[model samples]
Target: MRSGTAPPVPSAPARRLLLTAAEWAVLVAEWPGALPPGLSVEVPGSRQRNDAVAALVARGVLRAPVGGPVEPVPAVAADLAVLRRPLLTVRLETGGRGGRRHGWFALGADVVVVVLTLPDGGIELSLAPAAGLGAELARVVPEAAAVTGPTARGGAPPTGALPLGLLDAAPAGRGGPPPTAAEAALAGELLRRTAGSLDCLVLGRAGGPVGAGQVSWLATDGGWVGLRPHPGGSPRRVVDVVSVRPADLGTWVAPTVAALLEGRA
Candidate 1:
């Protein structure tokens, strides 16, 4: 039941847009296409609507080339949609509450990938069946990586701050880099073996409630998988721990993740 704050205001030259509810609805619905003829006009009847669209265009959230159709910027559209309707909000600190929400989005109901925003203006993603997130979306931020941590058990208290090893050590932010072929292959196989129930585990202090307060685990009935982001790049390395007893997860998962993070595995 946590609420979200207002959309962030951009720095100078990108003023905050005061979009009417009708205008916002239309913009969200008609993205990637030209506005309806009526709303595109600047006549008195439509001046306000047209002005809102123009402001978005000026901010580069929408594009209108000399003769091209006005369209929503793909990356901006993705970001805006997530901001408006986040599936989950995670707080990296154990007792954290209220401010500085880290949003999470399940790309699509059937899609296994989840995207999370980092507080340092970076982004991280998780792939249940490791795969490619298109280059356009990947480049939305300067720093991006795939992260895996401890899953939130049904009733267990939250544990672990969002790990900072990758972010702390990552070099200056740059264009998001796509995952490596090897990383994708490993993820694919891990998901296939786990019957597509795999998810990257995140160990964070607190998170907003999801439906029924249920959270997924990194381990599935088939086995367990641990993934770590490559500290030096966007690609990730994974370890598969199969046929292990549930009671042994404690003994095996953490050590496996540690080795993966240290590049010893």
Candidate 2:
């Protein structure tokens, strides 16, 4: 299966950590059988670097399902547990997977369903109300219009956390400014450029093999989604890692996003 986006470099603060010698031995590429009695390794630098290392030991390169019905499969039990109540779940076909309903899973909840064709990857989440929500439907916020609003074209700009509704908007009606997690952090100018409903979630360093790979934007490059295998012993063992860069970025991304002028989504 395809792989997800990788994490970023950890902070550079010199430090020391103690690990068992056997663990250290795992670092040895030459497959040294074992460590001698009474031994340990003192590792210096950030432990964040070893996140991939630990994941490899826990679950090696995950392989894609070789042959399974392309038809829909149930979401994982763990995944289901996390998705409860008012918090509805919707899947989008970031890649060319699934049918028209492919991205929209049938969860049946009081939620606005959105099918976002993100950069390279797709995410199915909520954009419902967190208490008092906008009664309005989705609309494409034109570049000029976003600024013309009463907030004034040259205002302080949006800061702090955006409303839950604004971030997870449904891709219909007049879609709002579809901001990527990246855009939300950046000044509104970056967001003003795009006018589409596709967004990216900046999930720090992708926890490799921890769950499925995570999806992230790569600035100039498109987006990528991580996919890991469901557990099964080999013959069944798939490739350890797979990375699928979306065929094209910005194929999505257009006039849906509006430049925020402080205190707005």
Candidate 3:
């Protein structure tokens, strides 16, 4: 990796990348904006560096959705029909090895969501709002979904959305008790900090043994934030936060978390 280097976005498992200032320059030098799906642009670099670039292409194509920030949900199979927005919903007439994966990347102020069904016998639902995410999202988006967006100041290894199901997966009478007033205030602050240009938010488990508490993600105008709910379900514990970027919206969260660890957040 040198002054000019841009990694490819993986396709098999949907992934997004936040290009470095230098990397962005390299990417724009060749191809600017989203390339056609399955298309690859040669990033400028040495053979070794270029090999890394090809590896990225093999893995996938990284770019923002042409449309805008959008969310994904099971089209027909999903019971939450309300969450379904008007996106270029493509239903693959095939299935995979029971593969169910989903991800999102940022483009400008807009975010794009991707859903895949691997092996060949499932529906791959990818939804992105033509007008990008709207204020109405507050009606359906969980307060925790924003934390998982493109928050890492640098970028995380594009991972799956927070498995929100984990929140309900806890044993009966769980969720600790009700949240206290202070706890509620903290949660509110976290939300307030990252609510302006929010695109998507998913509440899932943190990296830990099973039964770990829930962590909600926010893709906001200022940036991204990852926080876990108080055991009592009040103010969320901040896990990470990252400023937004251009190449991919959701690739900045890792650095945000690092900042928190470094006592900078």
lDDT-best of 1 and 2:
1
| Per-prediction CA RMSD (Å) | 20.1, 24.2, 20.2
Q: Count of backbone clashes for each model?
A: 3, 31, 43
Poorest 10 consecutive residues of model 3 by lDDT?
Answer: 86-95
> TM-score for model 1?
0.23
Write the residue-wise lDDT of candidate 2 on 140-192 in tens digits: 11122222223223333232323233323454243455545743454233234
Report how far residue 220 has shifted in candidate 2, in Å. Answer: 12
lDDT of 3 by residue, 1-265 (tens): 4776679754333222333323323333434344222222355467644554444344343332469531222331231132233112211111112122222222111233433322332222233432332321222232222333434333232222222222232543434355455544544444444432222222211233211111234444344343322334333321323322332322323333223323311
Give the Å error, residue 249, model 2: 7.7
lDDT, candidate 2, residue 187?
26
What digit string (tens of lDDT, one per residue) describes model 1 on residues 1-265?
A: 8688978864222112334443454454544233221122222236666776787688676788788877777755554554344332212111011112232322222222333334443334343311222221222212101121222222221222122222222553523454355544544444333321222222211233222221222332233333333244422222322233223323323333233323311
TM-score per candidate: 0.23, 0.16, 0.20
Q: How close to the true structure is residue 42 of candidate 3, measured as C-alpha lDDT?
A: 51
Full candidate order by lDDT, most accurate first:
1, 3, 2
- For the record, the alpha-carbon RMSD of candidate 3 to the native fold, in angstroms, is 20.2
Go through the candidates in order and give each one's C-alpha lDDT.
Answer: 0.34, 0.27, 0.31
| Ranking of models by TM-score | 1, 3, 2
